[model samples]
Target: MKSKGNLWRVSTTVSQVAQPLPEDKSVDLVVIGGGFTGNSAALEAARRGASVAVLEARTVGHGGSGRNVGLVNAGLWIPPQEVIGIMGNAAGHKLMAALAEGPSRVWRIIEDAGIDCEATRNGTLHLAHSAAGVRNLQERHRQGAAMGWPVECLDAKETARRTGSLAFYGSLFDPRAGTIQPLSYARGLAAAAHEAGARLHDQTKVTRIRQLGDKWIIEANGFTVRARALLLATNAYFDGIEMGFRPEFVAVSYFQFATAPMPARLRESILPGGEGCWDTAVVMSSFRIDEAGRMIVGAVGDLDGPGRPIHAAWARRALSRVYPQLADLPFEHDWCGRIAMTADHIPKIVALGPNAYASFGYSGRGISPGTVFGTQAAIALLEADESVLPVAPVRTHRERLVRAKEVYYESGAVLTHALRPALF
Candidate 1:
């Protein structure tokens, strides 16, 4: 069967209006790709009194931003201690401290902008799928406590009570985490940016970017736009722009399936604490409920291919295994998106030219990091200060075997979905 054109059809229904690009124009800043990073950067830059124009190949949030699982998690996928170990004390501490308030920043923006994205702040649960998983959670709990974070390690009984599933031995609960309707949130950002005086253009594909003397010239949709500065916020959807540098990362797919709204009684019993959750399986699985009582079960796979049935079946079985009461629920919506993963699982902001920068490689954690980094990037670019950035900008580097790693992740997803029962 042919795949659907838009994986996030449900979200597009209420999204903001898409503005057309100007025929020939110039702006202080031209942002490429209208995902979370682009929209957030545009909003911040405009708020800072800079003339900004955003060019999106499709609608806002058409990529991973729209297809995300909507978990507004604080920090990256790796724990704080692991981050410190990788980057040493000073740099790591900067990143950890900056991102520790990630979800708070995101929620504050949503509330201040009056975005109706089903925003929820009940918190998130990190379930342990195995004994080793439980041990890892314990270590994370300790590290989080040391940092004065509001994180708790729940025992098996408490975990079951919170998650409505006895399949896990233990879990980690973080009050800083929450969930949102990702597509709506993305569109809301675009709307807020527009309201803040940023010009947003949908279906405006940037074909080329080059530096002409002191200014950068952007060619898109049969027009040219000259800007004093440029921001390549494309992330995984980069289309070969000449930014003088590229992010060292590979794209991996993550998919989700949402069931029809469940009965109120059943919904109350399942995930009663209203926390978004993901387990510690090798090929991780996530579960959460929407305001409409729809159970969304997600895993790593391309849901728009021949493996759809396999992934769909695995989701059904996994849901049944975790919450037997809703075993018969039928999924109503299924979708997938690509996540940019770096070698060290860290996000990067590279300086491509005098006033040009490219930020990417979120490694499947976009919500809070995207907002925090984009906001900071706008401030740094406008004020010519790198001190406000979440992570130190990469001076210069080359990605080792990125193509091979991309293929490895895609092939691994296929094999994992093909052998679902055994693996799950």
Candidate 2:
């Protein structure tokens, strides 16, 4: 799919690893997708001595993995207490504890691989946009602190000082979080996997997948490849392969606009602490600085179709509202992508067949969860032990009414963006 605007047109620094599928070949593990999850799984599996092959419909990281907000956050979109409430204490706690170290694990791999994606470990801020939002941040701080997380609640003044934006009432800072060039990071993983002896096939779309005897036959691009195990990491970009098991979720679109590199004087005053930020609004807004010092502001909306006008208007107003200093800053880039969201907002790992699994539904929180889940999935498949996985693989579940939900989300974003400036 073509991107909507220039935001995705910015050149990523990561070099693409070269490997395309042979006319006919077989591997121990077949990973369908070349994004973070698939590449991470391939890397882990290959490191464990399993022969792995990764198939990408496009180039590696061409999906949402390339167009993310770049915040390397450490937890799920749902709070800890709510997660426990939904999944029961034991299961939820297990998942939470495993993911609590997600950012560290991601950075360790980046450092060890010597991938230069401009990884910065400063931290992240969950900004509170209203009085109620402040209360929410307070609760998050308390819960995170109780769990031994390095989280601090900052008052409005402190938040403004750090962010250079008085648009928030308060903020929750978590030292466990950070940011990266998402596309470069994903490509880095692919490169590491390639170096670790995994074969990566770009522009090879998997058209049909079926079980042939005890082996899995995956047909793509006029060729067939057999594998002992298969892993489906195609989240929102999943086409028509019905594995008899799929994620129960909706596809919500999120758009981003990035300005050209700010003046050196203004860059120091804006996001000086090098933390990525997002506000606590129903229709949330995110702001962060890229490695090149470009200010990227994003929100939940469709960058394509007629709703583009609404999103464009809101983005302009939002930029002015946050930093009047950059009121006239020309937005040079704009892009959007889909996020898979489960009804309960938790990711799922579903067992589709013997030695086959599919993982999806990270909502908008992909970086950490994708790496953690992909790595664990590789271990589980290679070692024949699911004990190491953060979430247990299930056999089957009901798919959500995704079409209706997607329409609803887009409609809501369009309406909200159309009216946001007036309310402000």
Candidate 3:
């Protein structure tokens, strides 16, 4: 997975690209990967007066950070109790409590650093695609409310008014969550890090990282960075550093298509509140309106794979099915990015070696979780403490039947999308 420019970079007008990594140098921290997590770690560490250097295989936001759905959501996809079910009581509670404020952290950074990436704080919707979906939302609402989250369940009428679509039976709305220009946010974080004395390098991939005594020797871009700590925040786009347990997870592809900005009348009536949305289905789908008024819809399956046509046609039909008023609106931009999905659908923080860690497997929730993990991972490394991390650093993380699971995911998405119209 080398650097591939995405729709975010093409459409965004943010100015935060960094030069390549230095030929050779020594720093307190070396962050491998310029996505949300790595950049946040660098920014956090550097702001605290630590000398930091961040290296990216491509330009800033070139990875999943640039290609994500841009949903700045709080918490994980599941409820707090389900989080407990996965990671046990104490650890799960700690992780959930920390991530519960993830969106707030992002908004605070955006405000403090003045990063203009279309920061919308209105809210986000978890729509129910069917009666079963509504029941799922009800359970989620119960769990969320019990955990003190101000989650609201909107009925069919409110859902229709908020989304300007009648496709969903209901929706679970979270006021703490919102949307952003993901690529711009990534670039903004890099710029803020650089301004805070962190050295950021683009197009410089770390080929190898080995410990020399207590310090780390990170080799990349025909140079080496000798640092006391290192953070691997590559997420779903690990190009190099092919050593150790590199966060085993299925690389599920998610594609999005952005339509041309709608006319004012249509825009006013469609998704009038500027809330990001995703439906609750086995093979999930998401849609949002950007600051420029363009509608971006996304779902599983690769846009460049054998299921390309199936996925593309599914997108067109799904968009029409959801928003009949905007049917036949041609999509202007179509792209795909990989998601690092663990078997448990939870993120992992793997302790690579002494003073080194790699955080990945964000599932599809990158923006907030990436920030939390990256920041905590860096703090843990700098402070020599694993207690600060959301997930206790694990020595190793593994995935089974990866290739088979990848096929299962794609085939399942294609099958679901192919049959969705009739099923609905």
Query: Judged by lDDT relative to the true structure, which candidate is superior, 1 or 2?
Result: 2
- Model 2: which residue pairs collide? 7-333, 7-334
Q: Please give the RMSD of candidate 1 to the true structure.
A: 2.0
Compared to the true structure, candidate 2 yields what TM-score?
A: 0.96
Per-residue error (Å), model 2, residue 335: 0.7
Strongest candidate by lDDT: 3
lDDT of 2 by residue, 197-273 (tens): 99999989888888978798999888988999889998888877634444567888888988878999999989998
Clashing pairs in 1: none
Q: Rate residue 404 of model 1 by lDDT.
A: 92
* TM-score of candidate 3 on Cα atoms, chains taken together: 0.97
State the local distance difference test value for candidate 2: 0.86
Each candidate's number of clashing pairs is 0, 2, 0
lDDT of 3 by residue, 1-424 (tens): 2223356877777796589875799899999899999999999999889999998888888888998999999998777898899899999989888888999999999999999899999999999989999999999999999888999999999999999987889999999999999999999999999999999999887888888899999888789899999888888888657465466889999999888788898999998989999888888889999988888989988887888888878888888888776677778888899999998888998888999998999899999999989888878988998999999888888899999999999999888877767222
The pairs that clash in candidate 3 are none
How much RMSD separates candidate 2 from the native structure? 2.1
Name the runs in model 3 displaced over 4 angstroms: 1-5, 422-424
